[model samples]
Target: MIGSGPGGALTAWSLAKDGHSVTLIEAGPRLRRPDFGQSIGHMLASYFWDGGARTSRGNVVFPTMQVRALGGGTVFNSAICMRPLESALERWRDEHGLTEMTSEMLDPHFDAVETFLNIKAADDDILGRRNELFREACSELGWEWEHIKRFEEGCVGSGECITGCRAGAKNSLDKRGVAEVVQAGGRVYTSVHIDQLIVEHGRVRGAVGMTVDPETYERRHPVRIHAGCTIVSAGAIGTPTILRRSGLTRPAVGSALRFHPSCYIIGVFDEEVNPWFGATQGIHATEHLEKGIKLEALWATASTFSRTLPKRPKQFKRYLKRWPNMAVWDGWVSGDASVGDVRVLPGGRPDIRWQMGDADLRRLQETNALLCEMYAAVGAKEVFTGIVGLPDVMDPREAADRLREGRFERTEMPTASNHVFGGSPMGTDEERAVCDGWGQVYGIDDLYICDTGLYPSSPGVNPQLTAMALAHRLGQELPERY
Candidate 1:
């Protein structure tokens, strides 16, 4: 395993339990409870790639977040466990030639994963004002909404899922799957960076790289590992870059990248929300999912929140004063229309290029409009649209109208995507996809990809659950095949 996020950790655990000798290598440290920071700035520097400042280049400079840790994004995400939508699986089957990628084939694995991770819906008791307000708005609008299902066992509702769960309630892979892998006699190496694969006679032998100090990031001892079979679960960006650096120059190696292209709006109300005290993201609406939109309640620390504020110091300060009475609601477009690619730069850095298609941008505009309506339904006094051309603050109806009717370009919107997919997609056509139906690299022997990078198209929902399901299925087959 070349990475130890959800895919990596879960796969490694499965292999280890099956009595396979597993070696899990992680680029980031095995952060303990104390190491998980409270503030967003501290957590980003510690857990995220590029201190959470990494962005794609092209038509729009959109931000992307990737985690670098033993448990990967499972440690930092809100633990939203959404099954792959049947419609998306159908698309994969019809358009991508992934005939077996259906709910019937994958639901058992999803069930096992949910059972192991203790995934369940968040209780109403912990759905603080922010989440409650979202639920109320959804009810008022008669849109279908539900409590977010999560891997929280003893959650205290600190609303710190993005930073890290300090209460030890979150079932992050580092605390669960990775730990089980170790107990089952798997070897785990932390802070090890794999530059490229060791290809011998057109087959992967293993990988080569160096270990670095977790905090200083100073290069340390040279490291190399030889394995009978190598699985790269290094996330959507990391996996493709490693494949490219290894001289796997097939066109499909880093092609067809995709994202959820998400943004959030703030609703300032008259009552105190204390947004930072509840489950990080506890309620979500899927009414517009057919249109590629998913809405949810969002919260972050004050410092992170301040970054989304207006540039005008006066207006910024004014918003800061209303923090206690504000709630953040966010939405994401499936990004089926958008496309991107990852290329390895001279020094092994990833150069990501992407462009948001006009169709997806319009979907985002509709998403913003829906969010405005939701806030308005709940009687928000004012809203911050965060679109460049729109006023920083406006009445809910005016914001909704501007969002619905405005002639907006992709560049005018501030969007980011925590959920990214593609690059080393799995498909029947070797000419288009880097991996095959079983996640085996098309032309490479004993090498596989088990990550979001293997997704041929958007899964149309939060992807962690589906990513794990794929990895779990791959794990079951690899031991038998190899």
Candidate 2:
């Protein structure tokens, strides 16, 4: 296993439990529970890729946060556990030849993951005022909504999930799957960066990289590991770059990149929402899912939230005072029309280029419009749309009207995405997909990819659960096949 995220950790644990010797390697350090609770800046520098400054390159530049810690993104994400939509699975089957990836085939694996991780809906106590307001808005609009299922056991609702769960309530894979793998006698290594694979005679024999200091990030020594079967779970960007560096020059190696581009709207209510004290993301609505949108309540630290405020000192200070009364709501668009690719740069870093299609941009506008309407229904005094050329603060109805008209260009809309997919996508056509439906690399023996990169397109929801489902399925078959 060439990563320790959900896919890598779960697969490693599964194989180890079945009496297979497994070796898991992670590029980032293994963080203990005590290492959390730091400021957002500190956490970003220590845990995020490129110190949380990594962004996609193309017409519009926006931050694309990718975690670089043991347990991967699961360590930092809100632990939203959403199954891939049946419509998305059907599209994959019809368009990408991923017939075996249906919910019927993967639900058992999902159940196992949920059971092991204690996945459940956030209780009312943790839903904070912000989440409750979202629920109220959804109810008023007659839109379907539900409490988000999360991998939390004893959550305290500190609203610090993105910075890492300080309470240790989040059931990140590091504490579950990776820990179980160790109990099963699997070898684990952290702060080890693998750049290339040892491919010989069309089979991956092992991998080679350098060990780095966990804190300083200074290179320490070169290391190599030989394995009978190698699984690359280095995530959407890392997996494809490693393949390309190892001379696997197939065109499909780094193609078909996708994302859930999202943005948030701040609704300033007369009553104190206390946005910073709640489940990081507790409630969500999928009523607009067919239109490629999903809505959820959002929360972040005061300093992190301040960054999105007005730059002028007086105006910023004024808004800062209103923070206690603000509720932030977020919506993401399933970026099916948008596409991108990952390429290994001349310098050793991965170069990601993505272009958001016009249709997806319109979807973003529509999402903002819907959020404005939701705020209006909930009796918010004003809203912050964050759409360029529009007033920073406006009446909810006015914002909705302007946003729904789609008067802005792509560049005018600010967007970011943490949910990225594709690059090493799976399909029956060897020439088009780097891996088969079973995650086995098409032309390579004893090598597989079990990550979001295997998704031929966007899953249209939180993707971590689906990624784990795929890994679980691959784990069950690998021990039998190899």
Candidate 3:
């Protein structure tokens, strides 16, 4: 295993359960459940890359927030355990030549993940005030919303998922998949960052990297590992960076980077909604998921909330005063944008650059407007958006007008994408895709990428199940090692 995120962890578990010798290597340190604390910012500061992380585009740095802990990104996610949207799967087939990613092909794998991860629909009894309001608003507006399935138990509805779950109830790989992998006789190396792949003549032989202490940030010792077959599960960002550095010259190595670009809407309730009270279960408007829009409710801790405020401190302070009553609605665009690239910097570091086109911008505006309507229809006092210098939309028409004007500078536009994918896509065409349908990298013998990087296109939903399903499928394809 080349990385210990969800895909790597699951793949390691699968292989180890198959009675194979497996070593799971993770770039970051193992985040303990006790380390999950009150200060969300402090936790994020330690577990996130580059100080909660950022991406760059021609000197413009866009924050790319991904978890650098043992569980990986799931540690900081909203715990929305959605299966691959059927429409999204179709789009992948038509647009990206992913013919084999059909529902039938993915059913058994999904079942396995659901069983192992303990996925269950959030019971209505535990829905927080905001989630209830959201449901009420959806009912009032006739907007379709689904009760999201989540991998959580004993959720006290404290909604600190974006921070870290203190109750240790979240379904992050650390708690579930990786835990099973370890018990199933898998060796997991924490704080071991694999910098480069040992590739020779189009075959992955081994990897060389160092283990660093998360607190001291000191290199522990130089280490090298030999594997019969190496799998890259360093996520879309880290995986592509390694493949490029290893001399895989496929054009799509760093192309078609699809992201579900998200914008958040804030509403102040008459009574305390306490947005940070539930499991942060993502109840999305599935009706619009394939149409390039999704509306879901979420919240943040104090620091992340501060980032959402207007640059003016006075306005921010004014909003902070009403923090108790504030609830957030997030709009994610399944934007018609392909990924750019994660270029290797001179210092052996990685830098990612992406640009959204007119269609994406339009879709963003449309989705935000829709969310505002949903909130406003249910008697929200006002709706504040992430767009800077734009007036808070009290009326639906004003919101539509703001979206119609398409002169947004990339700097003004937020460019953070939690869902990163397609650095090494699977396809039949070697020139267009990196891996084959079996996830074996083309032109490379016994080298496979069974992570989200193998996604030919963004599924516009949570990619966790999809990645796991792919890994399970790959495990079935592997021959017995004897």
Candidate 4:
């Protein structure tokens, strides 16, 4: 097993439970609780892939965050738990020959994962002003808003979910799945990088790479192992790079990337909102997602908050003064048909390229306007948007009108995605899929993938739960197949 994220961790734990000797190789260091802090930069530098500064190499330049630590994204995410939408997964079943996946079929697996992670909805007492504002706005708009489930049992509402949980309330893979795997006699190797799959006699035997030094990140000891089977459970970014480096010519091995490109808007209130005292995203609007537009209450540090601020120093500082009262709403929509790709660059690193279609950009604009209306309804003093030419939208109606017909050159809009999937999609179709229904790489026996990269398309929601569910499906079925 390669990678120790959600999909990787769950798959490893299940395999170990079935008496399969598994060696989980993670490309990052094993960080203990004391290593984490409120410093986002410190978290990124220590636990993230490429120090969290990686960007796509094209016109649609944006930060592509990927955690390379012991638990992968489970270590850094907001712990939001969401099942795959039946409406979206059904499309994959019909088009991608994914008969193994269905919401009904995965109900037990979802329940099991929820139990293992101790998933629970945040109670009203733990909610902050931002959550209250979102709930009130959703009620006024008659849009559905609910307490999102989190893998936290006794959360203290630290508002540092993205940075790394210091309170130890979060059930990240290291504390749950990986810990169980270790207790079950499974071996997990941190700071070990697996570069290529070792194909022997037309079958994957194992993998080879080098152990990286935790301090300098320099390749240390060479590594080679032989196993009965190899599952590439690396993340969406890491999995595709492995396939390309192994000389897989299938176009789908490193193409057809999908993401939920996100934008943000801030609401300035009369009272100090201090939006950094609760979960990163405790309340959300998903009921009226006819166009795949989702809204969630969000707050971040000055660096993260600066992403949507005006570029000019003077203008940016002006908003910084009112940061105490600023509460942000993160809006996201599905990426359009203008697909993206992740190719292996020199030295076997992944390079991303993406461009959003005009329709998708327009949908994001519409969502932005809708958030403005919500903030206005809640009596916000000011609405600050990240639109290129426009900064602050003081009037809700004017914001709606201008966003509907604004000259938003998509290149200028800063966009990022938490849910990146579909580089190595699952299907029987040769042209569009890199693997079969059970995550068996086409034409490569004994090699499989159990990660978000197997997603045929973006689920348009939180993908951590979806990734684990799919990995669980693979773990249950692969034993039978082989």
Lowest lDDT block of 10, candidate 1: 300-309
* Residue 90 in candidate 2, Cα distance off native in Å: 0.3
Kindly give the stretch of ten consecutive residues in candidate 2 with the minimal lDDT sum.
300-309
Clash pairs, model 2 backbone? none
The residue-level lDDT of candidate 2 at 75 comes to 94
Model 3: per-residue Cα lDDT over 67-165, one tens digit each: 787777877777777777787788778876778889998899888878888888877766787788777778888878888888787777777887788
lDDT of each: 0.90, 0.90, 0.75, 0.82
Question: 260, model 3: CA deviation in Å?
Answer: 1.3
Candidate 2 per-residue C-alpha lDDT over 31-73 given as tens digits, one digit per residue, 9 for 90 to 100 = 9988997588888898888998999898788689889999999
* Superposition TM-score, candidate 3 onto the true structure: 0.94
* Local error of candidate 4 at residue 15 (angstroms): 1.6
User: Candidate 2, residue 237: CA error in Å?
Assistant: 0.4
- State each candidate's clash count: 0, 0, 3, 0
- Higher TM-score: candidate 1 or 4? 1
Task: List CA RMSD, all candidates.
Answer: 1.0, 1.0, 2.2, 1.6
Q: What ranges in model 4 sit over 4 Å off?
A: 310-318
Better of 2 and 4 by TM-score: 2
For all predicted structures, in order, the TM-scores are 0.98, 0.99, 0.94, 0.96
